[model samples]
Target chain A: MHLTSVLVIGATVIALLVLAVYVIAVRTPEGKLDHVGGMRLVLWLGAIFPTVVLTALLLWALPAMRPLPHQSGDLRIQVQGEQFWWRLRYEDGNGPGVISANEVRVPVGRTVVFDVTATDVVHSFWIPGLGGKMDMIPGRINRLVVKADKPGIFRGVCAEFCGLSHALMAFDVIAMEPSAFDAWLASARGVPARADGRGAELFSANGCGACHTVKGTPHTAMIGPDLTRLGERRSLAAGTLPPTLESTAAFIRNASRFKPGARMPAYSAMPIEDATEIARWLRSADGEAGR
Target chain B: MNRDPLKWHERLRVSLWTLIVPPAVWAGHFLFSYLWASISCAKVGSFARFPTLFVAGTVVALAIILVSGWIAWKQQRMTGDPPPHESGTQIDRLRFIAKSTLLLAGLSFVAVLFSALPVAFLSDCR
Candidate 1:
């Protein structure tokens, strides 16, 4: 602890001892000691001392609580919260930048500015192991600054009670090395490869194109997550499913089975085989299928 | 609602208002200043012209605190008056309440001032 905290704690302890000695050890009604200093102690030490201590602590914490400057290596990303999802825009430092959903990427050892906001109900963006939560109020953008020292996939949850699927809404924070992050960004710009060509055709034909977007494809919609890099994600439906072919297929077929009250309509009528193919296609889209 | 005209409480409502006003002003100022600074600063990603908001808010809050303090001082001034109707203890209780409220006013004044200190050093609310 710092010297101020130590002094505060020490003063508090000494004050407690003095109070105990005065209140419990000394008899007040029987007049064991003088009463003149008693009122002075109560007024000065009891009341004013605490106020001074708290004020000092607040003063001490003020500087540390102030937001840090966005360093040269800082990454800027805008996170917009919806009822049950997060829309992300990574400031690629070039052009309008890379649009994404659910998953966020940042280089380890670099500060990240999450310019958080929401479209519908209020939501909060929180990465518990990383930093504090910032509210994403509708019509108001709140920024949360954080830094990660190690490269890992940290799970983030919506700390606000936004809607029915609030418990299911989540995202993944993938902190990678700067070189690896640049490579990932570069790959995200290109077309996603699919294990099955039929799945791409099915994805468009089923009207799923109206909500989701896959870059280099005709179907560009703003309602759903950008599927350009969906295959490269760690989880789907806001971390409700593992990034696997079976989970993808299952979620596409009947998302309500995994997460009841999910916003996506159930596609139970889709043929089991077609669902499996589409799931494989999405799984491949994660960019791991080629490896 | 069941207030009796003969009781000291009926006469003491003014003093109670005096006790309550400073903290209420403090709460309003605290919330407004933080939100105004946060929202305005957030929109532009900078603290440009934010010091004005801070200054205006702190000044308003300090003025309110001062006015309430003066009211509490008036209530305490009335503590010297002798009880009129077989009620010396009632006067003493009034004095006690007034003294306590004055002390609270002092503490809350300090709190209001302490809260404003952040606006001076912290340029942004991000």
Candidate 2:
């Protein structure tokens, strides 16, 4: 069983014991004890008994509170919380930092240190199943070191209230095997092969390059999230919708409809075909596409 | 009126100030623990591995509370009229205050120990 389950069960038993003691004390015969006798009873049961029990409990819980040990060679991932998205940068002692958005991937059974911070307002990075929440304050970096023992996809969200779309801000945490994760990270470092096509033309025509970045292309602006591996991301619009072709097109045309206060302006004037092409181009740059 | 069992100097020595000593030590320990943790995290990026200073502070607080409790225990055990202390004699009042201070000391001893528990467990700011 989980440590939390054991703690809850223990607490329930203690509470029930206390309740039983209270009931017994209240139901005891009145006038049976003198004032001195009553004072002795209170001193023993009320003061000494509780102090002893609490000290034992404190000792039992102290070991669990110890922080997990980490080393300098651990994989460091810097996660910067924006208004309604997560900007992720992976640094595995590799050449350059690999930037992604709205999704976090880690190697199972390995220490992953998240250097969490914020760009605008304060946010909190919380992956409830993995570790405790860490506040992401502007100009201050807070480190949240975690290790995923099992390989699976978990959902993480912004635990702190930041803006109108705070509830909509979420991310996917994918824990992969060490080999697969290493391969993915290595491939992510290389440029996508399919940066030119009809969809690419449409994406450039719409001036998306001025804000967003696509690796290996001249659109290297950092105003928005890097779409280098958007196609492989599990979710779109920060876990608001599935990363389907239609949803991507819809979001591209009218992002504000799904997430209020999003910085991406709605391209309501753009034709459906043009929006679809842009979305397609964005999704085609996965590492697999290059291979 | 019953003869004042406690002289004026003795009464002054066991004033309300004595009653508050235990809890005041507990409060000081609590504040000092948190401040120590905050400063350690800010300067060292984590709590010190040894934390000798924090341990010393806690030992001093616990020692003060223990001493206070011992004094109160001695005063409570002094010969006085038993049971219903309704006579409000000087001895009765002194014993009552002593008993109250003893209980407070017991409570504060545990409080200080509990406040220091976190230091023993958590080694980092997290």
Top of the candidates by DockQ = 2
List the lowest-lDDT window of 10 residues for candidate 2 chain A.
A282-291
**Candidate 2 lDDT tens digits, A164-190:** 999999999999999999999999889
Query: Against the true structure, candidate 1 has what lDDT?
Result: 0.77
Q: Which of the numbered candidates is closest to the native, going by highest TM-score? A: 2
lDDT of 2 at B104: 92
Label model 1 with its docking quality class: acceptable
lDDT of 2: 0.87
TM values, all candidates: 0.72, 0.85
DockQ of candidate 1, scored on C-alphas against the true complex (2 decimals)? 0.37
Q: Give model 2's DockQ, 2 decimals.
A: 0.66
- Candidate 2 Cα RMSD after full superposition onto the native fold (Å): 3.7
lDDT of 1 by residue, A18-51 (tens): 8886677556656654555666778787788778
